[model samples]
Target: MTSTPGNSTEKRQFHGDLIQLRGDRAAKAIWRRVPLASAGSENSIDEVALQEMLFRHADILALGEIDPAYRNSVPVCMELGTRAGAADALYLTPTGRIVLAEFKLWRNPEARREVVGQILDYARVLGSWSYDDLDREVRNRTQRSPCDIVSEAHSEVEEHIFIDNVARRLKRGEFLLLIIGDGIREGVRDIVAYVQEHSGLRFNLALIEAAVFRRGDGEDLIIQPRVLARTELVPRTVLVRKTILEETDDDPLEEHEPSPIEDENERFWRAVLEDFAFDDPEPEVPQPSRYGSVWVKVDGSGFGGWGLSFGAFLNRSQSGMGIYFTWRTGFPEEERVFDEIVGALSSNEELGSRLEGWKRWSAPSGPPRLGFSRNVEFVDGTTIRDFDEAVGWMREKFNRLVSVLHPECWRRLRAKG
Candidate 1:
């Protein structure tokens, strides 16, 4: 990320309050930072609780945002016993990449450095193992059945291929390392510099901030995960062949340095986020859907527990805005309201004209989409102004959508919900 005149990059942040609406009750929840320490008895969010919270909500790690290919990831185990010590959490992606995460609440500079060292040590120790060794350790530590270990997370991976891939990764010292803290406050430049100084190490590193917002009763919780910081990009790795040499039925390899096309995609989204400015009735503060997310939740707000977002799609070839018929599959009445809204939008002349050139794409296996969109291209020589113009178009149209649908249509639906 180089600096240019008049092109300052803002520190990415999750904006707005956590508003919860349950059973027609709308209670605005504030962004409550995790407490430092309890005054008396003991700390409420001890290290154990933090780990449990993270383990329970793996989405907090934002692995999908890091790499779209990591979609079907699953936690392998917690407190994975390593030669150095027990790492807080471990995950396995469908692509056979091992994601090791460690939880830390760093108050001082020294604690930050120590945590970085600990994470490196964990990665180093884990890097030095045979497939049998890694599998045996996972089997011994994990409460889940040994047979379900790889099959559950990645059913497509045969046991032999899974076994061989792990062995190869161990030999190559290739791993994705994460140093997670509760609402990271320190400047990321310093942590990135520290990781950069230790470039000899063979793993990609990232800094994540996991912010937890809870309701009064604590039963309802929302975790806003921010990649908050990143040190470097990992070479995109895909599950291709069992091994490079001695080809059998498998393809040779699906490994390569990150391509320029991907770099273009990331850069385009970053520009849109920085230049986002809405008009008319101001909505809630918007935030990136996730780390390296291609889209943003422009609505920054939702009614009936549904969000309206606008983002680049199809490798930046298309972009649009839409919200799903949320909570529709379960509660029949709520689904009715959402379905009615979708149906009304299609027939309502005023709303239908505004939605011209929009698309609602759906698949049998995936949720149905209801969006306003246009085809776009990010080919060679695409400028920052081009990115800004796209966002401006989205912003203007979104504002119009809000003005039309918000109070009249959305409020009515909210009342029914």
Candidate 2:
């Protein structure tokens, strides 16, 4: 491979052309043949610009080519925590496949290796989280729900399915780690291989080299990204390791064995139900949801069979109560009843004012409801006196709501015809 001084220039061009040929050779050659428009030199591009460009045009990463149904999202908690360190960019697929990425200039070998370990650590932290926690964190950090973020980009995605997929994938440790940079040097693949060899079922790592060229001195930057190394095969075996203080994998809405806090929650709600019985001795008995939320149906006066209900909940994190209007029929009749009931309650100044500060929920799978919750510092270890105070608080709120709504309810009955 000896070359004369004149041949040295040709040798460099040949090597550059080989890299270009792997992707779009025609475009690369045409751009190379022309002089780039620039008032000054084009060597000052930084990593921030690279990160922003990739985030805006994530499809450029070609994630869908791997799985046609897969879509991308930017999680606000990409840095994970102080222990896992921060990542440059993060993405998730439709089926909950995580794509962790870092953008570097790749001029430094040590920095590149460090990013690989950093992203891997993020995966370990993510393993302990459920979709609910991630969704809540995403909303807290971005001021937008994770569901809304994904739906904005992929309008066709179903919310429940998307969320379910994320839980499944995180539990299984199925993720893709991309290390993207400009001017990637040699020996990076060896580093990826060594890490991949010892790694388990969590993630597959890849390297992409982005070559940025200027079209004219204008802001027309042309970026050509080529995959230096493809993603490694994910293991079929699932490896799940829960974070120390995370929720159990069981669905919170389903019935499960009662915990200590659940027992206390049940006792408190039972006393409240007895107070409710002073008016209607045979009112439906309250039962506990999987997370120990006590709920039962109450008469809606003119609504007939369609009842109003309340739920009292307790958990290690917080405790709360909710008032719901259960739908008796299909969507058309249900909506009519909801409007009528809400309107009556709102017309009563006392009842409507009390309902303020409550949160509302209208999901497809269940009836519409309003809820109020308070953080609990000691859920499982609350004193019996505390439970008595909770029962009294709920009883007072319930009596006030029912008393004020009674007159408005009669008005609703007269208008129903």
Candidate 3:
């Protein structure tokens, strides 16, 4: 069966509307939470809360804060002794009046030495953990044997040994350090500058500022530090650079063109028109609806002719026994012309006999009544077979009528080779 152009256009329009509706719904859903603040009125976010947020949004926390559960879960190995405890612990050392913390196992051993040196500098200037008794305790804690642990004569040397081991780990890049306090401490800045100049190791540092308020009732309002890091502000430009590099490496040698279906509908329509012009002409036709009237006009003049009116066809009966030609009544002169032409065609003995036989077989009975009013009208005639056959007959009769009315136009059309 042939496809109607109108059907294709209607389908395309329906699909376009569906796409637009879906896009509008998606836009509404995505922007719905824009007005709300993500975090509460807390002045600072603690390690626990930070860790939870990091876990929830894994992509953003690729190598940041340590979760408490993760830190305490590390297995203890007796071979390392007390050093095993240090390996598992997330330590916060005093950097002047502020605290500089390192999350457990965040970096390698090489990087750990750099962190320890910075922490030592911070401790020296802050004067919080002096190299006296606490230093001796730290050394005793690290020693493997009882003699080494009890030896207090060279407390300075023992302290150096313990600190040196930590320093070596920091140098090997073994952990991550987070600076947490009210504001930037001089000691922290000095150590940061020192690390930047001496060690080329890249470290991510978060500066946290907190506010504490005490009321007369002895209630303390603790405002936590708001974490700030360079990574959170914008997307990484390095990703874009890498993408460009990859795309450039796999560049194609040649470009391909799109298929004909990708062209616009208008272009397809133009092509179809061109094809039609270059080929044989298609026959003119008329179609009939299921329930319609059929009216045939027969002129008894020498050139006997027959004409059908759609209005009369529809008025015959609301069944498959008539044809309805609505355009006939609207153009009376054209109708008269068509009637004269059909009269001539029907005068042909063979054609007229076939027409009469078709009418006799399909004619409706009784005094023809108007099936409906206004839009619905009946014709004093008979139908023939289905709508398709009726349409074919009507088209032949119409072409004959056109030849009689405008002989010159018909001749001109036929002359085109």
Instruction: Using lDDT, give the best candidate's number.
Output: 1
Off by over 4 Å in 2: 1-42, 65-82, 236-417
Please count the clashing residue pairs in each candidate, in the order shown.
0, 1, 49
Ranking the candidates on lDDT from highest down gives: 1, 2, 3
Error of 3 at 328 (Å): 88
Worst ten in a row by lDDT for model 3: 10-19
Candidate 1 Cα lDDT to native: 0.56
Please state every model's RMSD to the true fold in angstroms: 20.7, 12.0, 37.1
Candidate that beats the other on lDDT, 1 or 3, i.e. the better one: 1
Per-model TM against the reference: 0.49, 0.49, 0.20
Model 1 regions more than 4 Å off: 1-16, 20-43, 143-147, 233-417
Model 1 TM-score relative to the real fold: 0.49
Runs off by more than 4 Å, candidate 3: 1-171, 185-198, 201-203, 230-417
lDDT of 3 by residue, 1-417 (tens): 454654322121010111113545654211110111124533433434443333232223222343221131111111111211222122312110111243222122344345446443433322222222223334454533221332232222222223323332232222344543333333344445544444322233433322223222333332333443321211111134456222121232122232221122123223222322211123222222111222223222112222222222222223232222212234444444444435544576654443342221211211122111222221232322343444444344333332232342233224432
Candidate 2: worst 10 consecutive residues by lDDT? 9-18
lDDT for each candidate structure: 0.56, 0.55, 0.29
